[model samples]
Target: MKKIALMGRSEAGKTTLTQALKGEKIHYHKTQYVNNFDVIIDTPGEYAQTHGLGHALALYAYEADIVGLLVASNEPYCLFPPCSTCTANREVIGIVTKIHAPDGKPERAASWLRLAGCKKIFYVDSKTQEGIPEILEYLKEDGDVLPWETKPEADGKKRANELPQEESQ
Candidate 1:
C-alpha cells in the first residue's frame, strides 16, 4: 500500500488535513487511513522550526512515499523551512494549514509556499474543507507533480539546495 505521511509541528493541522483526505471526521486520533491511495500518520506538532521533535518527524515522513507537510500560513516564513524537505524525496508535497479567514486566498497562500520552493502547493482549510479534493487527486495520482508524468522522474531534487530554501525566520 502506498504511504503518505503528513509531517509538521503541533497545531499545524496535520490531523485535520488527514481527516479531509479520508472523507471523515471521526472522534479519536487525527491520523487517517482511507483506501490504498491515501494513508497519513499523525505526528506531534512543532511550533518552531528547530531540532528534536520537528527534525525527527521530518525524517520519518521523508522515508514514506509522500509527505504532506502542514504549515500555518500566518507563521513567519509560513513554515517554509520544512518545504525544503521536499528536496530529500520526490514525494514531498507542501501544504499550508489553518487558512480559513477573510484574507485566506489561494494567490497569497501560493505565493508564501512558493517562496519555500513548492510549485505545486495545495491549500487546506481545516474548518471549512476547502482544497481537499485537490490534495486527494494529488495523492491518488501517486504524488506526481506533472499531471502527465504518472511515473517518477529522475530529475527530482537530490539535495536541500536543489529545493527552495529561503532564509529561515
Candidate 2:
C-alpha cells in the first residue's frame, strides 16, 4: 500500500479531505480504492506532536511510497512551523486547504506552503472538491519525476479546512 498520512490539529478537516477524495460525505472513515499503482492507505488524522499520532505517522511513512501534507490556507500561522519535519526525507508534497474563500487566494496560499517545504504544491477545497484533480496530477507528476523505486519517509502531506489550524497549543 502507498501510505498517505494527513497531519494537522484536530478537526482541521484532515479526515474530511480524505472522505471527500473518496467522493463520500464527510461522515465516514477508512475507505479504500485502487489507483494506477497504489494501495492508497489513508489513516486517521494526526495531531501535532502526539506520540501515538507520531508513531502512526512514522509507521505510515516507513511503508509509504509518497506523502501528502495538507495545510489549511485560512490559518494565519499556516507556515509558522516553517517546514514539514517528517517531509525532510524529500518525498513530501503539500496541499493548501480551503482554496476558495471570499478573500483568500489559493495561488498565494500555495506559494507560502511551497516555501514552507514542498517541491510540489496544490490548492484544494476538501469541502467543495475544487482542485482535487489538480492535486492528483501534481502528485502523479512528482511520482513520475522519481526513480522507478522510491523509499520510505520520503513524502508527507497534511490538511486543514474552514480556518486553518493553529500550529501550537
Candidate 3:
C-alpha cells in the first residue's frame, strides 16, 4: 500500500481520517507531533498553519508516496494557493472532509483543491465511513516506478527493478 501523509489546517479531520483508514475506532486525539504509522503519517494542523513549521511538512512529504492535502467542507478560506501540488515531488491528492456537515459546501472545497493542482479529489465523512473504500483502493495501487528503473521484457511487459543492459560497441 502507498504511504500517505496528511496535511491540513486545525480541525480539518486529519487525525480522524488516519484512524478511519487504520480501521481503528474514531476518537478525538490531539496530534502534537508527527505520528508516523506503517502506512500513514498524521501531522499536527499547527504544522500547516504556522509559517515557520510549514517546512516540517515538506520534509515529511519526502517520506510518503502520496501527499494528501485536506480541507474541511465548511472552511471559509483555503490555505493552499493555485498549483500548490507543483511543489510536491510525489503524487498529490486532495481529501475533502466533513462532507456531511450541516453547513458544508463540499463542491466549493473540491474546487479549491482542483485549483491547487490535485489530480484527484475525494469527499469523505469519516464519521460514517463515506468515501473510505475509494481511498483504500487508491492506496492499494502499485507504487510508481521511475523510467530508468523499468526494463521491457521479451513478453512486451515492463518489469521493475531490472535495468536494461548496455549495448556492445
Candidate 4:
C-alpha cells in the first residue's frame, strides 16, 4: 500500500481519517508529533496552522509514498496557496474531511484543493466511513504498475524473465 502523509488543520480530523482508512474504530487522539504508521503518517495540525512549520511537511513527505493535503469542508479559508509549494517528488493528492458537518462546504473545499495543485481529490466522512472505499481503491491502483515496475499477474510468483536486469544479475 502507498503510505499517505496527511496535512491539515487541528479540527480537520487527520487522526480520525487515518483510523477510518485503516478500518479501525474512530477515536479522538491528539497528534502531538509526527506519527509514522504502516499506511499513514499523521502530523500535528500546527504544521499547517503555523507558517513556520509548513516547510517541515516537505521533510516528512520523504517518509511516505503519497502526500495528502487535507481541507475540512467547514474551513473558512485556504491554508494552501493558489498552487502547491510542495517539493516532494511523489504524487500529491487532496482529502476533504468533515464532509458530514452541518456547515460543511465540500465543493468549496474541493476547489481550494484543486488550486493547491492536487491532481486527485477525495471527499470522506470519517465518522461514517463514507467515501473511504474510493481512497482504498485509489491506493490499490497506485500499486498496479509503477513506471519503473514490472507488471505482476494473478499468480503469487514472478517469472525469472520478468525480473529487472539489475535484480536478475
Candidate 5:
C-alpha cells in the first residue's frame, strides 16, 4: 500500500479516519504531533492551521506517496486555494469528512477540494466506515513503473522481482 499523509483543519476527522483505515476501534485521540504509522501519517491540525508550522506539512508530504487534503462538510471556508495541489509533487486527493453531520454539505466541500486541484475526492463518515473501502482499494494499486525497469514477456506477463538482464558480449 502507498503511504498516505493526511492534512486538514481541527475536527476534520483525520485521526478517526486513520483509526478506521487501520481497523482499530474508533476513539478520540487528540493529535499533538506527527504520528507516523506503517502506511499512514497522521498530522496535527495545528500544523495546517498555523502559518509558521505550515512548512512542516510540506516536509512531511515528501515522506508520503500520496497527500490527502481533508475538509469537514460543515466547514464555513476552505483553507486551500485554487490549484493548491500544483504545489505538491506527489499525488493529491481530497477527503470530505462528517458526511453525516446534521448540517453537513458534502458536495460543497467536494467542490472546494476540486477547485484546489485534488485529482480525486472521497466522501466518508468515519463513524460509520462509509467510503473506507474505496480509499483502501486505491492505495492497494501498484505505483507507476519506470520505463526502463522491466519489459513484458512474450506471454504478456511482467515479472515482479526480476529486472532486465544485461546482454553478454
Candidate 6:
C-alpha cells in the first residue's frame, strides 16, 4: 500500500479517518505534531490553517505517494485555495467525511475539493467505514507502479522481454 498524507482543518476527522484506513479502532488523540505511521502521515490541522505552517505540507507530501485533502461534510468553507493540488507533485485526492452527520452536505464539500484541483474524490463516513473500500482500492492500485516498471515505448503495447530490468546493487 502507498503511504498517504492526511491534511485538513481541525475536527475534520483526519485522525479518525487515518484509524479507519488502518483498520484500527478509532481513538481521539490530539495531533499536536506530525504523526508518521508505516503507511500514513497524520498532520496537525494547524499546518493547513496557518499560512506560515502551510509550507510544511509540501515537505510532508514528499514522503507520501498520495496526498489526501479532507473536508468535512458540514464545513462552512474551504481552507484550501483553488487549484491547490496543481502545486503538489504527488497524486492529490479529496475526501469528504462526516457523510452521516444530520446536516452533512457531502456534495458541497466535494465541490470545494474539486475547486482545489483534486483529480479524484471520495465521500465516506469514518464512523461507519462507509465508502472506505474505494479509497483503499485507489491507494492500492494508483501507487503500485514500481520505479523500474516499464511502459509501452510505442503502439500502446509492451512485450515481456522489453520490460525494464531492475537495477542491481
Q: Residue 73 error for model 4, in Å? A: 0.3
Tens digits of lDDT, candidate 6, 69-99: 9999999999999998999999999999999
Each prediction's whole-model lDDT (CA): 0.60, 0.56, 0.92, 0.85, 0.91, 0.88
Better of 1 and 3 by TM-score: 3
Model 3 misplaced stretches (Cα beyond 4 Å): 142-169
TM-score of each: 0.62, 0.59, 0.83, 0.80, 0.83, 0.82
Q: For residues 1-169, write the lDDT of model 2, one tens digit per residue.
A: 2345555544445666766655568674432221222424454443343555465555666565666666676655552256655444637777777766676666766676676677777677787778765654444543242322232233532222222247433
Candidate 5 has which clashing residue pairs, if any? none
Model 4 accuracy (lDDT, Cα)? 0.85
User: What's the lDDT for residue 16 in model 6?
Assistant: 94
Model 3, span 1-169: residue lDDT tens = 7999999999999999999888789999999999999889999999999999999999999999999999999999999999999999999999999999999999999999999999899999999989887898888856744333355777877565654456322
What clash pairs does model 4 have?
none
Show the lowest summed lDDT stretch of 10 residues, model 4. Answer: 142-151
Candidate 6 positional error at 75, Å:
0.7
Top model number, lDDT: 3
Q: Over 4 Å off in model 4, which ranges?
A: 141-169
lDDT of 3 at 154: 75
Better model by TM-score: candidate 1 vs candidate 6: 6
Clashing pairs in 6: none
What candidate 2 gets wrong by more than 4 Å, as runs, is 28-46, 49-55, 83-87, 103-112, 138-169
